[model samples]
Target: MSDNLQNDNVVIESPEPVDTTLPMVIYALYLASIVTGGLTALVGVVIAYVYRGKGPEWLDQHYRYQVRTFWIGLLYFCLSGVLMFVLIGFVLWLVAVVWLVIRCVKGFKGLQEKRSPENVDTWLV
Candidate 1:
């Protein structure tokens, strides 16, 4: 009975662990950028760049997606800034915010599932 109890208490671990810490952190930073005025996103992008290609291939997809998100977002913001003179920049800015949020959320979901993003190369979520 004691041996049975001991066996029941034994914990079995996976042969290979999946590490999603950095990806989660990057996703959080991206979401926080909405309130932080893009500073956290800058940090997140830098981390993504530094860590890209250093992990599992599935994880590399996320890093690529994150890096693209930062650059594409910057482009959108710049275009919006230029369009402000015509009064359309405000709307573009709103769209950019929504796009960023969607991308971050999608990335978070993929990370949770331990899978690569489906559309890593797309500009839209």
Candidate 2:
């Protein structure tokens, strides 16, 4: 009786497909921004603006990540230049780059695995 009642009005709706490319695009823009600030940051901004309407929370998260990366890189770069030791800043910068790369790859893998959001730190960034 209970089983019949539960099935009588059940409705199924298709899930919306998530776009995975946006994150990759953001990561590429982030790398470019690091290599060439100002211009590259502008390029990143343009990309973000163009794709702002795309689906899924991941896109927004990636956009935020790219913007954060750009500002942090710029700040540390200027500070490093002024400080003159330079190597420390450069090393820190390299670490950030490597971390992002690793994170991007892991993000792809996570998408493939259909993992949960709590697993974000596995990407290492």
Which structure among the candidates has the greatest TM-score?
1
Query: Across residues 1-125, which tens digit of lDDT does each residue of candidate 2 receive?
Result: 99999999799888877766665666566656656654665676577666655656654555554555555656655665655574686766666667655655654565555542234333245
Residue 71's lDDT in candidate 2? 59
State how far residue 78 of model 2 sits from its true place (Å): 2.4
lDDT of 1 at 106: 90
TM-score for all models, in order of appearance: 0.85, 0.55
In candidate 1 the C-alpha lDDT for residue 64 amounts to 97
In order of listing, the candidates' clash counts read: 0, 0
Full-model lDDT for every candidate: 0.92, 0.58
lDDT of 1 by residue, 41-107 (tens): 9999999999999888989999999999999998998898899999999999899999998998899
